[model samples]
Target: MKFGVQYYPEHWPRDRWAVDAKMMQRAGVNVVRMGEFAWSAYEPKEGALDFTWMEEAIALLSSHGIRTILCTCSRTPPPWLYQKHPGIVNCALNGNTQPTDERYRVGLAHGEFIAEAQRIDGAVIRHFAGNKHIVGWQVDNEIGASNDCFCPRCREKFQEHLRQKYSTPGALNEAWGSHFWSYNIEDFSEVPTPHKRAQPLVEYRRFMSGLNVEFSRWRADLIRELDPGKLVTTNYQNIHAQHTDCHALGRTVDVNGMNHYPARTPELAIDYYRGARGEVWCLEQHTRLQHHDTPAGRMRLWAWMAIAHGATGIVYFRWRQCRWGQEQFGDGLLPHSGEENRFYGDLSRIGAEIKHLGDMLAPTRPRAKAAIVFSYESRWSFEASGFDRGLGPVTEAVDFHKALSRRLTAIDAMDPRENLSAYRLVIAPRLWMVDQRIADNLRSFVGQGGTLCLTTASGVVDEYSKSFDTPRPGRLQDLAGVTVSDLAFDKALRLPLASDVIPDLDGEEGSLLADEVHPTGATVIATHAAGWRKGSPAITMHTVGKGRVVYVGVRLSPEAVQTLTNWLCETTGFPKPFELPNGVSACERACDDYTLLFFINYRDDPQNVQVGEGWIDAFTGESVAVAEVPANDLRILRSGK
Candidate 1:
């Protein structure tokens, strides 16, 4: 329930600290995140280290009842440190990248960078370890974002990782399947750089992602060792980014945190970042992205949307726009002139509403009976193969999530290896890379009477980026009950489903891929309607021990996906949440005492919903029968207990 802004006392003059504090206090901001990117300001010289000014800023905010979410500023080391030490920054295959002013230019596995980061971060932790006003410790500023270092040291570390996984060159070549084209290596040191081959490229990506997690965990473990009581987390970039696996990062930290920008992000990103643990802080909630003037009242609506998806905190990126940095045009609550605008008014209203409703909303989170499984390995495999150009795994996953959310408001988007026993209908979209564990997980879910749906381009390869010598879908071929005779490459097929089975999906347009599925002891649900592919199976389903599995042979549009979701719900008798009109969202969060509903209108016109009885406005305590939400606005209602 923390609400605040990211403040930088070092970025501004010393005299304006009290004014910002007063303004934040008036707006009901209970927290301010600072000191994330101010490494040089703290230690301008090698022997000269000063923290008295930061202490003063903290005290000023604490006097106004504002706490701090201090970040360990290791993402960007002081420029002097880079100048003093050479070969600490990242280097591409060509040469070392310049401009040390940018953040995360250093390699993760570099010894020099790791040593200096630990030194500086350990000092920061000890300095404010006992500060009562400091509520949490953010480990780093979005680990693995804008990070794709391929330096010699990093490459050596990757080679070491490969060496550990496979003891010798023969084992490495066997797993990578690089015997063709005479790419064999005599030793681990002889392994070439990882861009040309699929398996090597995928392994490289896996190595780098693990390195990012390792670096973050180093800081996280350091925080716990030094300061044990406070929560520790690093802000995750948008879920669509394939660099760092959020699932692993979520498990490593105490609570998950995300950088949420609603203008360009989908609702699935918010729910996904709020991982299975269901505790997330929007560490960098967007007010206005660069050059994109968000519509009026949308800021408050976006904040509510985050809360609706189980974000426990909302901290805007900045209180005021920077006047002179690279992001000078970035928008915030107050303009660069330090004057309040419409966005500030929106923030003021939101703060008051949260002040009234945060406690009631704090204990509640989104509960789901439907889930979608995502795999980072599959995304990397897709990237390495280079065939998934127009429709990637992320696109299909996001589209499927949006469709599922239309029918079920609280659908869980999870990793491939997480627990699937909680969901009745689980959808796996374009699971192109299937490992043994993932296959076993899906089998267990379906064997226990949970209905599973898998889309096209699924199970094309095994864990090591090698095509399965057996039938497609690798290990799950029996569970899925279908064999792919041929898969069309990047074809846009026409689907004509059985009208008696699901009438709504008759005129479906399937795109991206088409698989010619031959059912074995299963029923064909749909077929291609056009010439040259007429009567070919486009979708198939089978009943396996007490459950059903559906295989979609082509990519479905969002509307068609929704139709398929509704048909699944009807066929399996899965309990679905109450529905709302298009462009209107109603997400429910409940406890034993009462149930709270967050209503958001994303369209230009207002939306109205009828509650049968016994609903009161959570903010005003007034009984409401029909909730009226204006254009780009939101409402909160509490059910009578």
Candidate 2:
């Protein structure tokens, strides 16, 4: 696997590049990601550009036998460019223009801004594209803005987008459900982002995602035009809910990369990685002492967990910790003194381990048997409005999905259009907003010998962000073999309220979004604790054409959900979770004639494990009846002849 670090040229002196690169090479690091926020250094003026500094930096790394992944350096616009072209500043939805304080503050729709970015991008690519030591290019650092742009250019573009989508103002009005408050429009320009309580929030949310997707596509095209041969990607924030369509974004890039921080548990990071397809990399990993908590295992454990989840490349955010800059972010392998620190020791150990594994993990990919439907549009719409005026179903469902994914072999978030027939189980947890065609496709899947699992608050809204007129749980009610009488709002219930039932509580009682069920030849598996409708069902199951559909009505704790899911997984023929020590994780991948098993132990304690017949350790190159794995270690076992 490729190991690297993301470096800021300004933070370290140009003279130190050669020494840093050599140290990294000695430590088993093979790649370096350069220049995400160096726009000011590269472009000192409007049309004039400079590559002298970058050329020296690249050559220094090449001399050390380290590969470089050059960035376009457009994420943070040069201060001079923003000053000259004020229109490039992004305008917020609240009618406020973003000030020149933070990075990534440029308006994506500004034509002149894009033209200058393209110019600088072409120059950078032309300089480094032919370098033998350069392996790839990163298009943009983190290409997302929190605020929706309300600039004139963005407004005009949104109108054109709506016209292309709806074809007419009447159709747009009907789709957006804009007739509630005597709102009528004759032109696309009449559409405005919902600010207060006046408009349907769902429509505005959809528009934000669509606009971001278009911007991402535009940025990807610019980079591809410059250099198509080298691998290209943009860093994504894993588990972030704002930019929902990352799977769609992944399609536009050569590799999928993520910046992950797992404050809760290592499993959360693994779960998020499993949700994306293609080769994955941790572009920015944390490693330093903290004021709040002790550095987690000196950073080695974190790196191992990422590798366990199939990270092809691992890179830290900094080569040298900053002492007098905004990046005093408390996480660097090297301290400000640039001496070998404790964290550096941890990194060196992990790097040695990777070298030992060598080709075994370098070209391997994760194999799985399950898929989860995760859509940015659906999640944003569900969070837009309506749900007892508090946290919505989508938020709760994401937590639940992450919990369940922790136990599975490989979990991926996929668009419904992606072929899911290969997966033994397909789950749509609280899919509130769905297109009609996709809904029909899901229904057809269950009809044709596929197992589907859905949850409450699903199918309640249609493609245009409008609620169905018939009843709650709209188009999927029939397919789910249940009907809704009323949405039981603000209801909290305890799981396994009866004896002989395992309560689904992590620690406390959880809330349910909606409650109603009229089964049609379906079995009621569980029910609510108490209410006027005390005996109402909370879980149901129905057998369709050649498969079955399971509907969970309320949120359950991870333990409870796993209990139920384990049963289903066994029934559907998914591989059983291999029993391992506390910090040990094992996963298997197979080729036509061979099977490779990855065994990773993230703990500091040694472990003794049985070596099944026909397997040999890839790292130690030893054949034995049984073996003991050392502390903080990883092993790959290939099938023996």
Candidate 3:
């Protein structure tokens, strides 16, 4: 695996470069990611470009056995370019133009902006095309971190996009179901920027979200055309930033990559970005959160967590804290005064450990027999509906993933459209909108002997963000063998629910929304214990073809959900391979030669995991019957297959 640090050579003096390089070499950081936000430094004035400094920096690092992953500097344009073309400045949804001084916020789809970005980007690529030590190219810094523009130009482009998709205003109106408040339009140009309205909002969300993918692909293709051999990728924004569809971006790039903050972002994000590609580079691993100090051991623990979830590369976000900037007290390997602290100690330890374990760990990817499906369209649809809006589709997916990961070795967080042949149990939570393709894919999975679990508030709308004329649970009713009669979504109105398959919560009142499910030919496994809707089915199961479909008609607590996942294994007749203690997890990764399991303890103290037999410590090469993982640390065990 590539062990590296994100270095900003422009931020420091030329003389200090050797000191940082030597420190990196001492710590086993073999690669450095630079130039992510150094456009101004590259081109001090428009048309006055100099790549000599960066070349010197790369050569300096290379002398110490450290390569570079040069990032295209287009994301941070030089000040002069913006001063020349003020029209490219970003505009918010409220019609206010954002200041050009901002780093990432820009009118990404603006014509002049694209031209300028491409100019600088093309220059950077051509300048570094022949660098032998460069291992990869990050197209842009963090593609989805910027806000989507709502300027007049974006309005025009959205209209053209709708015109191409719908072909006619009438068809667009029909698909959007715009007749509710006479929101119908005669021309595609009549559509306004997304601020109100359901259908248009969802379409706008999708359209604007796709711009990130389009932009990344443009850069990636440019890199391949100019510098072809190395990998091309873009670090995605934090998982909570739903502005862009990550799965789509992952598919577009040559390799999937992400900026991961382990403290703030959930661990599922590491697995989510890994997706079908099965490997992701954690481009920006956090050492601290927003000037606050992270716990002593967490930085190393988070790195191992990423590696466990199939991170082929771990590049700490930065090498040094900036002396003066908006992000002054930021996460860095070294403090602002270039002083070594506990962070450096933690960093050196991780570097030393990965230096020994990287080869065996990097070659192996995560393995999962079960998956939790998430959809951007479904999430967008829920956003359009503007109802029952508490925890959104993302929370639902993450929660289910966490619950399953607790019991199972590793659980995949996948897009519904991805391949389902490899998984035996697939949990799709809150599938609010169902397209023909989505419905067909899910139904086929159930038909092909896959246990599919779906939740409430699903199947209310079609792909076009219009209500389905059919019964509730729209396209999945037959496959699920249950039709939703009605739903109760009052957060305070917790119904007393009981389940035979899941553990009892001692009248804790977990089900948030109760769907009065009327099963056509399925078994009712759970029902309302005591309520106005008492005896009504809250959960159901129906055998379909060689498999079955379990329908959760209500949102249950995290504990209840995990218990239900256990029941899924029981029904599928597949025993869970191993179970770890709470606050500890084991991820299985393997190749043709061997299988490895990384036991990670998330608690504050040490924890032990049973290794059974035939397993040797990956680093020590000593057989272990029981492995004790340090607090916020990990132990890797390898077995020849």
Would you list the C-alpha lDDT of every candidate in the order shown? 0.83, 0.68, 0.83
Candidate 1: Cα lDDT at 162: 89
lDDT for each residue of candidate 3 in 1-641, tens digit (9 for 90 to 100): 88889999999999999999999898889999999888899889988998899999999999999999999877677778878988888888888898777787677788898998888888899889878988899988778677588899999999999999999999998898778788799988898887767788888878888888888888888888878888988888876777888888876678788888988888888878887678889999887776575778788888888888888989998888888877887677788899788888888999999888777776687777788887888887787677644556677777787777766666777789888888899988888888888889998888889999998888889878888887789998898898887877776867667766564633435555767789997898888778677878888899998989989888888877777777887777776546588899888888878898889887888898876889999988998889888887888899943
**Which candidate, 1 or 2, would have the higher lDDT against the true structure?**
1
Q: Spell out the clash pairs found in candidate 2.
A: 244-376
- Model 3's alpha-carbon lDDT is 0.83
On a 0 to 100 scale, what is the lDDT of residue 538 in model 1? 76
Clashes of each: 0, 1, 0
Q: Write the per-residue lDDT of candidate 2 for residues 1-641, one digit (tens) a residue.
A: 87878776667787777778878888888888988777788877776777788777877887877788887777588788877888888887777888777777776667887777767766777766667777887767766655357777787777777788789988877876667786678998887656643234555555655655565666567556756677777777655546536666676677777775554334444444445463577887766544455443546666666765677788877777778645675666787888887777777777888888756666665566666675666766666654432244444445545544545645655666566666667787777776777778788788777888887777777777677887656887777888777655555545442212334322323255545777876787666656555566777788888878888777655555666676567777765555567666665555456656766666778876675677777665667445566776656677775
Q: What TM-score fits each model? A: 0.97, 0.90, 0.97
Q: Superposing all C-alpha atoms, what RMSD in Å does each candidate have to the true structure?
A: 1.7, 3.3, 1.6
Q: Model 3: clashing residue pairs?
A: none
Model 3 alpha-carbon drift over 4 Å, by segment = 388-390, 503-508
Q: How many residue pairs in model 1 have overlapping backbones?
A: 0
lDDT of 1: 0.83
Report how far residue 181 has shifted in candidate 1, in Å: 1.3
TM-score for model 1? Answer: 0.97
What TM-score does structure 3 among the candidates reach? 0.97
Superposed by TM-score, candidate 2 places the C-alpha of residue 209 at a distance from the truth, in angstroms, of 3.4
